[model samples]
Target: LSSSMYEQIFDRTVSVKQRDREVSSFQLTYWINWHRNRHAPVRVLIREF
Candidate 1:
């Protein structure tokens, strides 16, 4: 019973780590896209004027 509990804990930790990695990567890409989009309009305006 103790061993099974330990296994469950380990599995939970691994899943949490995996979720964290996925969230970080998603946030990174989202930030990059936002930065690009935010700057693009300004760049175009500067070019136009």
Candidate 2:
């Protein structure tokens, strides 16, 4: 997917870095609540530069 698509899916706009470098990051969260106890949702972060 393109940058526009990434921005749309992540709900944020992407901007170019001004210091002659670029960085991209994303986060995803999910959970399964089939057990009896409550717990925090799993989260993952992806980064590319």
Give the Cα lDDT of each candidate. Answer: 0.48, 0.27
**Model 1: per-residue lDDT, tens digit, 1-49?**
3644544554464456456756675664564456446443334224322
RMSD values, in order shown = 19.4, 12.0
Mind giving the per-residue lDDT tens digits that candidate 2 earns over 1-49? Answer: 6644543433332222222243322221221221112322223112311
Clashing pairs in 2: none
Q: Which candidate has the highest TM-score of all?
A: 1
Which candidate leads the pack in lDDT? Answer: 1
